[model samples]
Target chain A: MSTPRTPTIGLFGLGAFGRLILRHLGPHFPLTVHDPVHHDSAPPERAAACDIVILAVPVAAMAETCAAIAPHLRPGTLVVDVGSVKIEPARVMQQTLPAHVQIVGTHPLFGPQSARDGITGRNIAVCPVRGRAHLRIAAFLRRVLGLRVILTTPDAHDREAAVVQGLTHLIARVLVEMEPLPGRMTTASYARLMEAIDMVRGDPPGVLAAIETANPHARPVRDRFFATAAAVARRFESGDAGGEDQRRRSRRALIG
Target chain B: MSTPRTPTIGLFGLGAFGRLILRHLGPHFPLTVHDPVHHDSAPPERAAACDIVILAVPVAAMAETCAAIAPHLRPGTLVVDVGSVKIEPARVMQQTLPAHVQIVGTHPLFGPQSARDGITGRNIAVCPVRGRAHLRIAAFLRRVLGLRVILTTPDAHDREAAVVQGLTHLIARVLVEMEPLPGRMTTASYARLMEAIDMVRGDPPGVLAAIETANPHARPVRDRFFATAAAVARRFESGDAGGEDQRRRSRRALIG
Candidate 1:
């Protein structure tokens, strides 16, 4: 009953993403932040005491971070995770947090790089795990932050992201590492591929690893992607005249 | 001594790309088109009679098409083949055409799909093979059609394009075939990937095959891409904690 009618927000982790949330949400809410990196940041206990706590840590650290704040979280406090992959984070918050504390998993599709211009009209996927706090936060995300909210289950988010982010980052990381020659002749599609690479490459290795590894569905999609890529490479290597028809047939199979 | 002050243009093939070129070039020059599929079209001999004849056939048909027109071509006529892959076409034109006929291999990097809005500011790779006519065509491409002309060798164009269009169509063909579930939650990078797919997938099967197969360099690039992708997949599949360090090391190797 002592929780404020307008939730006081506590933001955890001050990495680029955490700082991004702070930059945008700082002015709008009664906000305090906790990041071990910053001496001035409120302590871990202070984050637990807030009415709404946002975890913006790397996915690899989700469980430990959740455990750190669980004991101190008020009965009615809402814990929101801003991790890219949602399934494991949702499960961690469910298991580690006090039964009375509410949890919702969120993946803001745009990062500081993509949203450099602004966050208005951008998308944020909300996977409501426990309690009614998700409704409140989704409304806040929509009305206050001008985000288009897609309410999805944690599994659905990961499944789609397996292909979306999974394929995007997988292709991008390899392309960047290849140091592809600067083509004097580039097509519109090729230019767009480069743009996607630029957008995803700014993410840290841990973030990339988490998206690829932590999500269970990601592995299967990744396997299919590589297998198909291998098959295409083999078909090309064979240099069979009939391979064109075979490639088309395989392409049709994949399209389906 | 008369190669006509303004070379009359003859466009061969009436596929989407050929039609696109016609739409842009039709009004500016004395133009005629010959598509065997169309009853009212000018005959192949008529196409050779034009001072500047453009071959817009599929790469598979380039040699035969060249043979059909070579004997009829006026002595000073410039023969341009707008095939997606250049080396084979360049050689075919050089060997099959009359030595008196000029040859320039061009790959307009836009098609009806990419150029739906119009072709201004788009790129066109001009590989001058057997003539000074390329200079005239490049100037016309820059001055009249507003194309950014990149004058490169056929081998250089194919080499870079292996990674550019080869990687593009290869990935696109796979992604399109996968028919990924409609992602209600899409990111900026994901949207760009989809846009690139849409642009390239509209191209016909023959074009896709030619880009992937006819260009010899494409096979090596495709092999390297899939190999690197497979390595990444294996690293993730192993689920080794130290795999991250290993991945970065291999990444450095690839970058070199």
Candidate 2:
């Protein structure tokens, strides 16, 4: 049982994203994984005693995960969480983990569906919370994984995620609900919109939950979008020239 | 004039789309151009007397343009329109122009912005309203212009356009109005959404007007999109779990 503990990775939560991390990082490192709900509950301390501990649980389960792994974590161990929203998870890891343990928060700006082809050139926002260990993580993501690493603060990441992931998921869900959209007679622009929908349509429920609910900036962004849409709708309904009157005239002209 | 009339193309309306047409077709044929407002008015009669008369005007201006060109069009001449909507322009051309003049309605799916690189592999809906001249037009579009020709009737084109052009323009307009969207830390899906907006943001007011008002099927599609969006908004604002409760928990967990 003399396995060298050279840069071992202990990954928790066998969710969609957890599996993705495993598939990509498995060949490069000695990997140990545990998911209490999905996989065999390997002793928490054994998985936690690795060189790096990655929590891939939902944002809702972040607090409990941190508390469970806190005592077992070694002093120099680096802890990272891959959640859609950055600020909350960053805070949780920084506060709950031991002061000597390093913490980094990352939001892989893609899902299993979007990264289906590959993760090369995909963006990953890395927010350093407790230590400079993120520098190494960012380098590995860029050099080895062929990812685009965005070094940013947790708050800044959430600010942009409000519009980036929030609006994308929100718009995509609504558009998917309006499914059976036109397949024929599509323009270049329409095709692009469909592509955007296709990228996010199959995202897991927790991904949307973290984006729309867990992120603090998400609501304001969503509200602003809805308000703007309502204003546009009102402009059309109020008999604007390009609305009721012009529509009627256009209809009459077509028939006559 | 001693010039040979080798399939001369008479183009009207020197707007963005008209210029695109002139740039593409100018090299292939003897050209006569007239625009009452933009360029010098070369008299409607001269432009209408060519082998192919193209009306690149607004949907609202379709009837007037048709009436102006009807008196001068020769028998066996082809009259085509490049409007966003198909049914109204097709009907207007069929009704106002001389019966002997062949009427073909074309809606180029790619605009100047989208086809800036080239018009190769673009889509153009060609609906034959009066004569079989559309077959030749379709061939030329496929072979010469390298466009994909969709031979659909006026109503069928409008039905599909209502979803394609209508949704693209409406959503684009709302998104454009909400300017300064997330530029950095954007996911691939968000970038695609931005690309869709970029393609249609520069489109003229008349293009949006035609999509939202002129096309009879446009209104219902727009209404359905708005209704679907409203349902999504309602789900969030009603203190839904993924909305308020989880949001509050997320914030508290971050602090504690």
Question: Best TM-score goes to which candidate?
Answer: 1
Computed on alpha carbons, the lDDT of every model, listed in order, comes to 0.82, 0.83
Candidate 1 local lDDT, A1-256, one digit each (tens): 5875666998887878988998998887888888776777788888779988999877777777777787788988889999889999999999999999888999999998899999999999999899877787889889989999999999999998898888888888779868855656889999999999889888866678778888888889987877776676666566642456635433332200
Mark the regions of model 1 whose C-alpha exceeds 4 Å error after superposition: A1-5, A238-256, B1-4, B240-256
CA displacement after TM-score superposition, residue A237 of candidate 1 (Å):
4.0
Clashing pairs in 2: none
Candidate 2 achieves a global lDDT of 0.83
Q: List, residue by residue over B45-106, the lDDT tens digit for candidate 2.
A: 78889999999877887887788778899999999999989989988887899978988999
The weakest ten consecutive residues by lDDT in model 1 chain B span B247-256
Candidate 2 lDDT by residue in tens digits, A1-256 = 8996569888877778899999999989988887765435566677798899999877877988898889889989999999999889988888888998999999899888888999999999999988889999999999999999999999999999989888888888888888899877889899999999998877765577778877889889888887888787666555352445444443433211
- In candidate 2 chain A, what residue range of length 10 has the lowest lDDT sum? A247-256
State each model's C-alpha RMSD to the native.
5.8, 5.4
Instruction: State the displacement of the C-alpha of residue A203, model 2, in Å, after optimal TM-score superposition.
Output: 0.8
